[model samples]
Target chain A: MRRKASLILLALAVFFTALSPLLRWYAFPRLAKIPANQYQDMVLEAKNATLLDYGTMQAKTVPKVTIVQTLKGDVDAAKKIDKTAGRDVVVWDGLSYVQGPDGKMVSSIPERYIFDAHTQDPVHATGEMVDGDPVKRDGIEFKWPFLTQKRDYEYFDAQTRTTNPIHYKGTENFRGVKVYYFEQTIPWTKVPFPKTMPVKGITPESVAKTGTTRWYTTVRKFWVEPVTGAPVYGEELHKEELRGGTLLGDRDKVTAFAGDVKMREDYIKHTVALVKSNRTLVLLMVSYLPWGFLTLGLLLLALSLYLEARSRRPGDPASTEVQEPEPVNA
Target chain B: MRALIAATTGLVLAFALVLTITAMGSPMGKTSPKPLLTTVPAHP
Candidate 1:
């Protein structure tokens, strides 16, 4: 019995250890999946020094945009676009309300965004997002178990219309939460000014003849929790430059923007709340169960090894019984 | 005891193997390509 128990325990340990990674990789994607109809609030802002540096200092007001995101439906048509159907797709609708000149709140940005439940990749985006096409190629695809020393995320630029890499910087504790740090460098993109804006050196004639002069680039940093995938803090550094007046002169103009105005104020109270409030099942599946299985399996294995060794001792009845007495004979 | 342990352990191992095999055959991420790069360019 002891020998048998040992074998069983050892087998269980091996089974569990081997199963741990597979479960983590496959099960977590489904287990921790985000659901439809959940909501998130994203706020963006620009200040005085930033506006002044960007040549909009005289504007006399801080610009702010507050958007509310709501997931509307499930993967009713994910296969239509993303063939992989590897991810659960959701239809997300959004609206941004801003104070109108009359002091009444009026709707500003109305749009739709598609997202994958597993990876949180934005599949399709329209409206203001499509204008710049900034998030390129599943920009936020994160492999599950955000716990890692270093990782890279694929990001897209709207102005240049290309994809770039977001690199993991390090980890640090923020607001009592441990978080992973990542930074992405956005290469400078040629400024495409609107016809109405009065650029100092450019005449209608030069505007027609020239390609571009003013350029903008951005640096984005994120601090996210490993288990919950919640962003405890984030910041964006927006800068602009005029290369030798490529538009007309040689002096480079650079401006640094304070990105995500409202986020800085609240420290992701909304998004963090959204994550913390939801996914009871998902969190358990992704983070705890697999580890539990591994621990149980290892314990069983150790017990089994001990039993097998005890059964093999020379003084043990089972070991001696296995050897036949000099048999019979006379 | 030997009979019971042997039977139970064998059954569990077999069951685990089957589960893993099923997962492998299913539409898993492993079988799917790197989804982002594979997507058709959305830009105009």
Candidate 2:
């Protein structure tokens, strides 16, 4: 009985020790998920320049930015796709508005997107983007699973109408925990669009000089928690320039227009605060408890072994009980 | 009787500890990021 009990305890200890780290999966998504009713207040200062002549610099304009992202889960995007338990598919609309000289706010380009609740991929968008294929895979946009290891992510670029394969840079010490770094580089190219399309917010004289150049370049970088796949900090810098004449010619001299040069920075500071608070509990379970159970269990097993050996010594009561009865033969 | 008692006591206590820790250690569900926009009015 003693031996059996001791063995059982030892086995139990091993079970917990081995199983601890795997619990990260269960803890992360449930603990760190982005809510459907999420709202973010951020600003993007668009740098626009006015030229005295074709090449002479004149003045600069700083536009105001107040973007609001809200979820619309009620609208069904795809009926054939099955709903996932614990996950909601949502369409989030973001409007980037810049106040014009008339003092009225005007809509910015690439206004809206749809997203996976967990992945943050822009699965769909409307307007000029309606014809282009919806984005398929964007891994770095939202919360990463706790089990995520080293990986390259194809972060979609809505402006270019293409997916930029942003490679995983490595891990960084972030907010006292390890987070991942990813980056994207977009070279100059004609984004998928029709030529001769009217460019919004540009003067006809400039538009006539411009003749519609769809060329653009973009780059983005982000830091995310590796364990939970949560983003800590992010920055995206996208620059575009309209070459003079038509989209066909690589006319370098006639840089007719400097496209939108904007930088956006975002971080989950509040999420970090919550993560810090939960760190202790996660650490105890994944690191401390297993070792504690194993050590205590081994000690108990050792004690049981010693007690058995001591009781079985030649003159001990247990040994005598087993000895043959000589005088009791009467 | 004494050996059985000691063995039973140690095993029971260890098992109880494991169970207590497991139950106590269940992860608490974190509240989703706040100021999550429940409604966005029609654009002007």
Candidate 3:
């Protein structure tokens, strides 16, 4: 009975020791994965430009650029500068604008704006439009409380905390693969839309009267790897699809779409390699380490049993047992 | 009692072996860098 109990306890100890590190480092990291639907505003900054060669179809070009991304959100307050005599600038500011796709009001933000000019320099502006409407400011036009509807803009932090609850949208197809999707707020650098028409250049004060700004929102698709349980990729189409009155229009005027599928794949490859090359698991399964225990336990148990068996020798059986002397001798 | 002592000793040996193997493997673990892509917002 004691031998059996020792063997069982030894087996348990072996199992637990081998399993502890795997559970602590590998299994746990994989389990605590970030969900696809909850990611918002991840900025992908390229360290160096990448070259893409399309054989005979296209020339090799290194597109040096930085990308800013955000999930769709509500346009709380907006200003439209439809008509600026110098440069057609559209400014969207204020705090009251916090409706996101998940139906929560968020105030955190980084200053983001897009104007029709690459440089906010003084330029000749023949025509101007704000929120798709031409503005005619007579004099001193200050629309703060009226523009933002009396709300302040929220600033985002490095930690990227979620201001609202996560609402899981259904799965959808991206590029070619099907994936689960969610909404997040990402940042993007503005691509300047410069309108170049020859005219008398004016100062900010000259045409400042007729400019306005407005806020808008659009939905994006997030793709995740089902097997790995990682946020693999996603894309977003601009809210306003049409540009310059055409179905297929210029890239800047249409919308901004972004994705991160390729990067996620690379990370997965590295993880698989790291796990497979794990030396501990391999040695434990194949080496003489485990067999040593089996041998020792069996040796001790066998010796004990042998000793018990030898105690039952025929000649010694009666001698081994103690007997009381006869009453007659007393 | 001898048998129990033997098993306990073997189990302790097994723990030592596993720990050594794991430590050797730690240096081989690798974390690949994330792929990054940026598209310049098309200018009109």
Give the TM-score of candidate 2 (chain A).
0.57
Clashing pairs in 2: A37-B36, A37-B37, A38-B36, A38-B37, A39-B36, A144-A229
Interface RMSD of each: 12.2, 9.2, 12.4
TM-score of each: 0.57, 0.54, 0.29
lDDT of each candidate versus the true structure: 0.51, 0.47, 0.32
- Candidate 2 lDDT over A1-330, as tens digits, reads 444454454454444433343333343333333344444433333345321122232223434323333322323432212153234444433433333333334333333345555445444333213223444444334344443568887665655666667778998887677777877788877654322223344443454565654466666776766654556666555544554565325555333223343334332555566556555555565456555755655665566566556656777654444345668565
lDDT of 3 by residue, B1-44 (tens): 75456556655665575556544432211222221112212220
Superposed by TM-score, candidate 3 places the C-alpha of residue A98 at a distance from the truth, in angstroms, of 24
Task: Give per-residue CA lDDT, model 1, range A1-330, as digits (tens).
Answer: 666567667666766766666567765555444444344444443333233223432222345423222223323344344455555565544444333222333223334456676666667633224222333344653222333345776765444445678787888876556678878787777754333333355343474464435567778777777676656666666665444444434335433222343343453665555445543445565557678877877787677777788888988886554554687898
- Residues A1-330, model 3: lDDT tens digits: 433554555554444444455434443333222111221233332223322121221212233223434432112211123243332233322111212222232122222222222122212222222222233322111111111111122222111211222224666654444445555443332221112111235222332332311112333334443333234454433221112322222322332222221223333344334323432343344333435434554555565555545555668653275557868863
Candidate 1 TM-score to native? 0.57
The superposed Cα distance between candidate 2 and the true structure at residue A306, in angstroms, equals 5.5
Largest DockQ belongs to which candidate?
A: 2
Model 3 chain A, poorest ten-residue lDDT window? A139-148
lDDT of 2: 0.47
Distance (Å) between predicted and true CA of A286, model 1?
Answer: 6.3
Error of 3 at A324 (Å): 34
* CA RMSD, predictions in order: 9.8, 8.7, 20.4
Better of 2 and 3 by TM-score: 2
TM-score of chain B of each: 0.51, 0.57, 0.51
Q: Score the docking of each candidate (DockQ).
A: 0.07, 0.10, 0.07
How many clashes in candidate 1?
A: 10
Clashing pairs in 1: A6-A304, A13-A297, A134-A158, A136-A156, A213-A247, A242-A253, A244-A249, A244-A250, A245-A248, A245-A249
